[model samples]
Target: MPSGRLPVVNPWRFETNQATVQIKVGTYYSQVWTRAINAWNSKKVFTFKIVKGPAQITILPAQSNEASLIKQNFVGVAYVNHDNTKRITSVQLHLVNSLLKSNGYTTSQRVNVAEHELGHAMGLAHNPSKQSVMYKTTRYVSIQPIDVKNAKDLYSIPASQYFINLPATTSTTANKDVIANGAGDRLFKSPFETRSVQALVDPSTIY
Candidate 1:
């Protein structure tokens, strides 16, 4: 049940039952955020969809906090996966214009930081390399390469993996390996799922 956020238990990943991120922005920055997420997901097989429309974004009075971030968390800090109903796994925004200026990143650079952290909200972990959007550090623009690969890997975990029940196995080499060892629930072909999925695990669900 623990998401990837718990580094001590499950490092390099995290998940939310759900999250509702309020993307606080100015009119111009609003456009920038949309463009960034679009470009970020364009190269990947998975896409992060906005849950609903007519969203309310919060744009607090900006303050100075860049130096504090670097010396402290090394990234901007926000509540991670703290949604009561929808878990907002992460959030970030420029606090003080002067704070970013103090740290030597432009407005665009600050947006990159925001985008990178949003990527984390979407279940990405920090990558050490500059090539990744998940990369811990960027030159101030462009999400390099490794960032996309890591995101894909995180996204590939099948729904079944979340639970303890294993299913039919597949081969590794020339022979199909029975990795599940027949201990899994069942691997019945589809179309029967709606009527008989309970049978897939146990027949008790059926009256």
Candidate 2:
């Protein structure tokens, strides 16, 4: 809302200001997720609750294929799924541990990346300012006042305005991918590129 601050991914927040989360990563990385969650929770603008059963948000270590995308410099990616009404249904957050380790990211730096991905899960778009946790590329920064204000602005919107009408033939599901590059340069994949992580890293394989 402030000058130079990016807006939220409009109308993409969960039904309420809070959502259930389930972390499927290892113990060490689980702690990282917890710290990131706590940071956002401290803002009191939004809340992420850890749950055992099905959850609206699921955090996990990157799969073999997904982890391989790290070679392109992406350290994390958040895949957001929504229902026909445009309400956020579930979010799959994959933390690419392989890249983080190979790049020698410190624990705090890893938490920074987690916070960035969580921001995406909360429907916050990337802020061009490097000081915010929602920066397009993950840096050593954590959540800032601007980030909190953005979340507050998003949740403050009335529930009635959250849904947008769609065509009768619209699919029941839709997805959006938000990626974080380790290099801190361009973070999103080119739309013309193939989805295969291996092909993305090795162009020769693409036909």
Candidate 3:
């Protein structure tokens, strides 16, 4: 992976006041998964809530004959941060929506996707790290660290700027970002922060 940072030259923000969105669910349902998905969306918004009577479900053309893995229509869909305020369209995974419950994953997988897509609609791009919930691939059935971090970032910036965060304006010459992150000893660690080895390992980095 590239050691260089993706420039945060601009802070991310969007018009969230009275933001409106439309979620289209294709012809498939995963009641348990859908419930989980909805539950998760309810929490994504920082200042707003999913608008009451605003969430609409649409049953559209879907390739249902395919296996759950192959199914391309839906498990569920929602909007990002779309309360009575800001909005973005969100969608669930292809076919796994209904299939996950049978395999013991259940609603968690749908919850994961709902969180991720909503993350995107909220203006976050894919996080390349495997540790992230916003990673391009769905490796689990629940929210991960990346999910919380990015979501925090979504609301961190003030609404008026909507384009840049404050940190970028500071001179790195006087305020070295690498030196600061290095202070945290951000060396490689397992995706699971609570793994036994990590628990036993010393966090101090050796120069």
Candidate 4:
């Protein structure tokens, strides 16, 4: 709602303000993701718990450059699943571990990237302010006040406004390709275009 912040359209948000997300990793990277989740939980507006099993929100390590469905050099991607009503039912977060290290992201930056992607999953759009974690690209290592305010504002909106109505007619092959890409839900891409940091959304297929 603040000025200078980029608007987010058709935000895919959860039904409630509190929910746990499952991380798909069993490595040190999981620790970094935990930190990101903790950072967002700090706002007290929402709580993200790390759980197991087939979760509504899933976090996993990107296997290779092929993880990028947008054909750009990206570090993270988040796919959201919404029903015909438009409320988000599930989400998938993909992080490129090898690319992050090779591209020189420090432990803090890695955590920041995780946080940024999670923000996308939460339905926050890219903000233009460099100080905000929702910015399209940045070296920021954590969430800013504006980012928190943005989250608060986003959640405060009516649920009906957060969703949309899309056509139901879709192809089976496209669905298979999305599954093969590991984008377990509908694709939505992060707006960032460079090596700094970003989230992901797949627009090629419909679900």
In the order shown, the candidates' Cα RMSDs to the true structure are 18.2, 6.9, 14.9, 8.1
Q: Once model 1 is optimally superposed onto the true structure by TM-score, how far is the C-alpha of residue 60 displaced, in angstroms?
A: 6.8
Residue 34 displacement (Å), model 3: 5.1
**Candidate 2 residue spans exceeding 4 A from truth:** 1-6, 165-207
lDDT of 2: 0.69
Q: For residues 1-207, what per-residue lDDT tens digits would candidate 1 score against the true structure? A: 324432111122234222343455566555555665566667763454443333212222333644543343233333232222222223333333443455566556656765665555555545545555444454355665555555555555544463234232322233222222121111222221110000011111122
Clashes of each: 9, 0, 7, 6
The candidate scoring highest on TM-score is 2
lDDT of 3 by residue, 63-153 (tens): 3543532232223222122111222222222233344444344345545655554444445555656566555454363555455555555
Candidate 3 global TM-score: 0.43
lDDT, ranked from best to worst: 2, 4, 1, 3
Can you give the TM-score per candidate against the true fold? 0.51, 0.77, 0.43, 0.72
C-alpha displacement of 149 in model 4, angstroms?
Answer: 0.9
Candidate 4: tens digits of C-alpha lDDT, residues 1-207: 546754442345677666678887867778889998998998886788777777778886555545443345456766655545446666778776655766677889878878888887777766656676765554454788877777777777666565455542322223222122222223432221101123532212222
- Backbone clash total for model 2 is 0
List the candidates ranked by TM-score, beginning with the highest: 2, 4, 1, 3
Clashing pairs in 1: 4-13, 4-14, 18-87, 19-87, 63-95, 63-96, 81-89, 131-145, 132-147
Q: Single out the weakest 10-residue window by summed lDDT for candidate 1.
A: 194-203
